[model samples]
Target: MSTARKHDPISVQDYLAGEAHSDQRHEYIAGVVYAQAGGTNRHNAIATNATVALANQLRGTGCRAFNSDTKVRIRNAAGTRFYYPDAMVVCRANPPSDSFQDEPVLIVEVISETTRRIDEGEKREAYLEIPSLAGYVLVEQSSLSAVVYQRGRQSGGDQGFQRSIVSGLDDVIQIDEIPLELTLRELYEDVELAEPDSTDRS
Candidate 1:
């Protein structure tokens, strides 16, 4: 029998370089890459609600927002990374590539059950790597709760911490970059989340 030696895993550099040619988009984590799952109807609706709401609020402002289809590059000490955010707003600087916005002032990821762990853990860590990143929003599909992680320092690195969780629908997250406020309910207006069953006791 013949035995073959396995090769090393792909690095963040390799993933970013071949992202365009790759079959699908993947999230970078700890120098490893993982593919994102296609979201559900509820997920889509939730993301749409947030994006449109932000668009409406940021219309006259200089910042422009995008949906999950937009690619993003976040840099950390490990390497420069990339991920597709659910709702992203950029107003910092325009780049020559004109393909994907690099520095977004605000980024929101509607967390799905399948991707929730990564979004809350890996992706959450990845977005903080960006220097221009002032805020990171995580929208929960199971409920109306949304987590907002903000950076206190004008610059990036290990200077910021998790600001707070904007759980209540009435609560609003302040976007210091473009300078706007988004309500939790607004981000889940069209979203029809599942209701908790009363009889399902373990």
Candidate 2:
């Protein structure tokens, strides 16, 4: 089977220190790194649409939301992550340049069939490890569904402990840390379905 940047295994720190101006998105797993294919215009639009919505909702608040351009570092030696998210919101304030975010209140990843399973499965599992993470949201570009996970403690029968998965966007998802009033419709405002040739039409 093919791997996503399997040739070279790098630490989270090493991947961050390097420049990403070369293009091609990348994902980091454990310690290995790999590149991602460019998304179609619709894919790009979905991400942009969500970013704007979140940004607008978060304005004036101390919280800050970022597009894929921002690097999310976690559990590394210093700052930066092996993989960058499609969209993210941080309630802890921005970090200094050259350093990645150590505290993130919310993380959002746009689901792609190619990576959807992993994003909702393996990637999700990895995100749950972040101590400062309050929520993780997934926006499905296909059905325009948003799956949200929130931080809190829940009673699990005799074994009560920490829990997540606050609510979903089958109706409309709201992220508590990121202004707590955003709706899924805003994230899909201008998004359209992909064509047969995979071209995004206006």
In terms of lDDT, which candidate is strongest?
1
Taking all chains together, each candidate's TM-score versus the true structure is 0.77, 0.77
Candidate 1 segments whose C-alpha is farther than 4 A from its true place:
1-23, 28-33, 93-96, 153-159, 195-202
Report the poorest 10 consecutive residues by lDDT, candidate 1: 1-10
lDDT string, candidate 2, 1-202, tens digits: 0154643667665665554454555666566666666667777787888778778878888777788777666664433345567777888855456435667778888766666667877667767677777778876666646677776643652221133332234356655434465676677776775433443211
- Deviation (Å) of 161 in candidate 2: 10
Give per-residue lDDT, candidate 1, residue 60: 76
TM-score of 1: 0.77
